[model samples]
Target chain A: MVDKKQALLLEDFDIEIVSRDLNFYYGDNQALFGISVGMPAKQVTALIGPSGCGKSTFLRTLNRMNDIIPGARVEGQVLISGKDIYQHGTDVVKLRRKVGMVFQKSNPFPKSIFENVAYGPRIHGTRDRQQLAAIVEKSLVRAGLWEEVKDRLNDNALGLSGGQQQRLCIARALAVDPQILLMDEPASALDPKSTARVEDLIGELRELYTIVIVTHNMQQAARVSDFTAFFYEGALVEFNATKLIFTNPKEKQTEDYITGRFG
Target chain B: MSGSFSENLIYGLLRAITYAIVLLVGYILFDIVIKGLPVLNWEFVSGYPHQSGASGGILPAIAGTFYLVLGTISVALPLGVGSAIYLSEYAFQGKFTTIIRMAIITLAGVPSIVYGLFGLGLFVLFFRFGASILSGSLTLACMVLPTIIVASEEALRAVPKGYREASLALGATKWETIRTNVLPYSLSGMITGSILGVGRAAGETAPILLTVAAFFLPKLPNSIFDQVMALPYHLYILATQHPDAEKVRPMQYGTALVLLLLVLGLSLGAIFIRAHYRKKYKW
Candidate 1:
């Protein structure tokens, strides 16, 4: 654990999320240790690591999805847009609405495609059919799925292909009009074609949403992200520009892991 | 000793055992239908009894059975399903929840005659509701409560956890998620369970015998307080307790057939609902 703290020099680009010494635990087992990183606004920051390296755990901390697990606890601060979300009396529902999330496997509700996209607005007290329709359409279009699924909006969302279902989940998260989007291996389960489609969709979504994606594919990290953070054994090993992390030297562990010598 | 020959023998034995059970059921049904069909006329159904259920229709018994089923369901459905939702959605894993689950299982195993005695002591004596529809319905509801809760809870549990997570992640409150997503998918299961409970409630003679059933009141009940003739109790009296039980054999068969049909009808309806839901949500 010596020389473990090597801070990345965050340049003047606006930071959308800041984690100061975040530690997370599930019961007695700790999963993340003193992870500190700044994700710049409107740019995709990819968290890449070997399996069980706490990248997904860190990703879930941003939206507080880890709160669902029993005996799961978090220490330290997670600030989004300058507000400390872990502070007491913070409305978690409001926080989730602001910081939307897409999970590893696509989990569209067993509902119609239109309803899948419109679920968020409907629950937040939007009763008018017209407004819900408009929001659904806008979300689908932003997710790059509207033209493909416009005519069959009433069809069961489970009937969609794997890639479409994943995109539908993204559209659902976007329908809430969140400032930040957290994706946990959003394309890991899809075919290559579907993965390409989702990657392209992520490229478009980055312009409006502050995207933080957790991926297993290093090539995917290089292709889609501006910044990359490498994690190993529940500690953040390196965080820098994707080009520098990929092309130049950093921590011996990161260079070794990324170069396929060992995970 | 050949493998295929032994496999064929096992298959044949299973088929024969299944056919034997089916044949027994068919024989009983055939006997009942043939014996009851001779007297099961419109007049026999609609007309009032002449001399202590010796002749005429079993209208009052039919009406009483209907009332008992209605009252039992009205009392049990909400209580059972509410407890089920609480158990499945809200109750934490602890000693208290375990106690509740154990109590429900124990209640399901209690004998119908014991339920009758309990109803006799509680609703008839302590509460002084006396021998009336209210007492009978309350007793039957208690008897069926465990069934409804178990079935409804199973249905609630069958709803995928992912659905609940998706709803909560979309900023829906826990109650809102349950109301919209959980309840809709589990409704068919709940209804099917309740229907099966209703069937059990209808056929239960011992509970109603002590609580509400009358041996010879061949008329419709005007109020919940009225003691009425129910099909199962009526059939029991005509079969065993009547002064001339040997002469009224046809009426006994008819009553038995009607009760069987009522229970079978409810069970079939539940089957239909289960099938419909299975088609709608394959996941």
Candidate 2:
């Protein structure tokens, strides 16, 4: 069953992450039910659904972020670069380094802006002062926050505006140089202008990295993603090109959700 | 109009009660200051007590109290903070953890005199350390351990979960995330909590009386094992045990005043440090 799904998903593009029949539970309450999907490399994939529909859970399982939650349990395989992440002896720290994440809310550490960006590289063993400085600059530039924050890199990160802080969080994630980025509603808390800026940033980032984003806004999914997966009630109702999912969804539930009929 | 009148009456009653409590505390402080000031010269502060503390300064008692506080801090802060980190960050929430939490809360309410007796049994008699500064400090540390642990755990929990998640998502290990993100932010709170413990340890007399206090040792301790004079015990002796307690009334008030000042100074210093760190880490 997994092999057939893999063949179908691998038909058009190179796959960076694939979860086969993934089931997740928190204690006795199941949150995800046999989810299978593939995210293409160097492309943006958006998971859209209503609140508590397990889009965020699926995103977190890619990097095992849910491991920190008490009683959270996952079954089936999450493959990153064709390696099953749940297998025995897999190093979670190394897995997370390869697949970084951005949370729904901006959560920069209470440190200097420079320190916030430098944190990832420092933890991964980049030690020289000059090397750290260069990494910090490159990450900030890539996140498109360097121009605004270059003069105040030493200021406390909490002092930044909300939108700027979100960008700084992106830069911090980028510093580790992950190949895949998992974002859980990265712009849901932002103003319209900031949201547009983040959407544009996402468009630019897809050229260099595989991005999987979970969002509730269908318009955001349509604007920023190449592929869209519509999740409802912990099940994937449809997965296809973003244009098809929006205009000609195969599943009735997908059409209903996309057309604002009912969640 | 009736509702407004009732509200105003309640508000006035509450304000009056608050002012009454304040006035009571102010009267006690005023009485102490008025009696303590005339005898609080350099001679009284720095000179050795003579004739069973009937006349002279309380330098030895001051030094002993300072040493006791230092020892309590050195012993309690690390143990308490470490336990707090384990409880808040690492420990799995289970029956075991719940029991541990219950034990800590119960320990916090246990009487200090009970701790004094425990110290007498464990450190003084069983360990055979005798009535010395080492025994007294160990006792005080045990007594304040619960307070520091409870406060430090509260501080650790007060930090937003987002910081830990952000650090972990950035590929940092659990300990590394805690070291960089959690501890630095919660440090001011932990220090503030520890200073409260230190204040309690410094002012406590019963624990030291059973474990280390010397009634008339008019000199500083030379070693941890040596008996030392403490402000509370000295004041207790001057107020009640001294043969000429009537003549030493001013000395008693002076010793009480000095001890109060020391505890207040320690708390104020900690408040300043906490404020500085709070400014640095606003989130």
Candidate 3:
């Protein structure tokens, strides 16, 4: 074990969310061990792992979504823009305002397309109807869903096709306008075309928001992300530039994952 | 081969018997409808109790029934739904909470007459409220409380967790997520539950007797605190206790049919709202 302090960087970059020695547990079972990852400002960092490897658990720890689960516990430091999200004075609600998420399933709120997109902005106290409309429009446009559902803004979101619904969810997350966006396989439930569109949208969003994505598809990570982190059964195996991790990896586990071995 | 054929025949006979029992309730409904139709005229609905306690309309009793049912609903719905929200969304499920929930479900299964007796002991006796509409409504509300709570909890639980996730992910608090998304999304189901609850309460005869029984010798209630003639209590009395009841038996059947129609209407209304929203939600 080398005291390679240089393995982790914390000097100059704007850290949107910095997790150090983060661990999680569900009752007696441990989901994640001590994991450290630096999520920089306005970049897409993908967390890729196989089934039951704790990628989702790690993503959930960021905003304390796991707190909603009974007997779920965590020990660690997860800082969103400098303040630790788990600290006593930290308002989880306010913290969530600074960090948004999109889930794997396209869960539009069974409301209208317009209302679904506008839900977040409303919660944040944006009462100006016209501005809300603009935010909705801009968000839908950003998620690449505006062109399809623009005419049917009042139509229930549940009525939309699978692809359209996922984009609507993205639009909803963007409507909150958080500094960081967490997407757990946002495109996995989508078709290939929709996946490509979401990938493109992720690339576009990277210019403005810090994004942490969890995906099984390695090609997706290579295509749209700046950084990629690999996890295997609750440990961070590697974290590096997308190109470096995929083309010239360090650890044998990372190599195995990239080479399509048992994840 | 002979034994297998007999076994099949016996199984078929059992199925037919079970189905016949299920369909038997329809025959009773037909009996009520056939006997009640002629006497269910506007004059009978609009009139008051006549001389010798025969031939008059049950307008005041009918009116009192609506007033009581509505008041009970108004009393029970909010508290029931509020409790359900707290239990389902806020309460951490554990052994103690499970015990509490078990007690509640058990409370629901307790007989209506026992609820009436309990109401008599509580609302009427302990509270010293007397046999007024307020007391009756309160008793009826207790009778229906479990129904509303179970229905409401089921409805709340049926709301997809993703909706809450979407709301919370966007920075809304748990209460806000419930208020904005889960509540509205489950409104249709909740209403269906409420309708069923209302129907149960409206049709319930046993508890109302001990808590709010009326001899109906005549008059209308002026307030919640006033003693009013509830239709079920009125029907029960006219059917069983009326001294010259055979002469007015047709009116009792008519009242029964009307009660049936009212419940059917409420159930249909619930189904309508549910289907309307479901259609709107369906892709």
Best of the candidates, DockQ: 2
Cα-based TM-score, every candidate? 0.94, 0.97, 0.94
Q: What docking class should model 2 receive?
A: high
Which of the two candidates, 2 or 3, achieves a greater DockQ against the reference?
Answer: 2
DockQ, all candidates in order: 0.65, 0.82, 0.70
Kindly list the per-residue Cα lDDT of model 3 for residues A1-263, writing each as its tens digit.
11132244323347688899998999999999999988778888899989889999999999788988999998989887788889888888888877889999989887789999999999889999999999999999998889998899998888888888988998898888888889999999888987888898899989989999999999998998878889999999988777778887888999998999876
**lDDT of candidate 3 over B1-283, digit per residue (tens):** 9999999999999999999987898898999999989888888777787853477777777777888888888988888898889889998898887987898889889988998888889988999988878888888888788888889999888888988888888889888999998898787777789878888788888877877757673677777777777778778877888897898788788888878887888799889999987776542
Can you write out model 1's per-residue Cα lDDT over B126-227, one digit (the tens) per residue? 999999999999999999999999999999998888788777888888899999889889989998989998897899888998999999986799999999
lDDT of 1 by residue, A1-263 (tens): 12232234345468989999999999899999999888999989999999999999999899888888878999999999999999999888898898898988898888899999999999999999999999999999999999999999999999999999999999999999999999999999999999999999889888998999999999999999988899999999898888788887478999888899886
Off by over 4 Å in 3: A1-12, B1-11, B280-283
lDDT value, residue B71 of candidate 3: 82
Give lDDT for model 1.
0.91
> In model 1, what lDDT does residue A156 have?
90
What's the candidate order when arranged by decreasing DockQ? 2, 3, 1
TM-score of chain B only, all predictions?
A: 0.94, 0.97, 0.92
Retained true contacts (fraction), each candidate: 0.58, 0.77, 0.77
Query: Which candidate number would show the highest lDDT if scored against the true structure?
Result: 2
Q: Cα deviation of B265 in candidate 2 (Å)?
A: 0.4
Winner on lDDT between 2 and 3 is 2
